[model samples]
Target: MASLNVGNLGEYLREQRRSAQLSLRQLADAAGVSNPYLSQIERGLRKPSAEVLQQVAKALRISAETLYVRAGILDEKERDELETRAVILADPSINERQKQVLLQIYESFRKENDFETLSHADADVDADVDGSGSDARPKQSPPSS
Candidate 1:
């Protein structure tokens, strides 16, 4: 992960929990975690695993990717997707539940596309993940002064 303001994630989490109108104990119960643990998470004293984050997102009726982005756990691909989610959340018209529904639909489509791509990977396409070798994408040339 790149550089991120990881400390502010607790404030963000606290704000989200409050926005959802859930008490600390309530969210902890909903996320199937202990109250003190959830409190610690909100205080930035601990980092939750992906599974726990997913559970918290479900309890908050929000995207797990949001939590992942906040915690600086996303890869380049997910970071790109996070930009879209941020746009959606920034829109003042949609409420939290609406945002959740939209995110769910969007995520389903992405998952479907990912499944299709993986299932139908071209046997002839032998590009390395690091963009090395015979692949033909344009490369930056040395700048002439």
Candidate 2:
């Protein structure tokens, strides 16, 4: 576990809530936490677990990894690489083999830079077991003037 930076995390959460124009109660309700608990978290008087942090991130409609990094749950570099890998894996335009090949190349680059390489299993991706990839989009017709 990374060292907890409760103060920084609290301040960041406060700022994000304010930026989203949500009150403490609103955020708490949305995050499925008690109002006082959320308040304590924001005031740096309590350390929230990752689950709570994830709920708060969802309520804020922001990246959960950002909150994780601020709360010392993940390193900044790890978050960056994780996000990149997630994007690569989620791209429906690429086939499973192509995605795996791209990940191998990406991991190699990271390894060359002395970064810890993450396995494919570390990402939350739906496997394309059918061997078919789709990047389907609804066709949009031009508006008539």
lDDT of each: 0.83, 0.86
What ranges in model 1 sit over 4 Å off? 1-5, 75-77, 82-145
Candidate 2's TM-score? 0.71
Q: Tens digit of lDDT per residue, candidate 1, span 1-145?
A: 2323555767888999999999999999999999998887887788888889889989999888878878878865887788888988888998999998999999999999998897656432545554643665878999999
Worst 10 residues of 2 by lDDT: 124-133
Top candidate by lDDT = 2
How many steric clashes does model 1 contain?
A: 0
Candidate 1: 10-residue stretch with minimal lDDT: 122-131
RMSD per model, one decimal: 11.2, 18.9
Candidate 2: regions farther than 4 A off? 1-4, 115-145
lDDT of 1: 0.83
TM-score of 1: 0.52
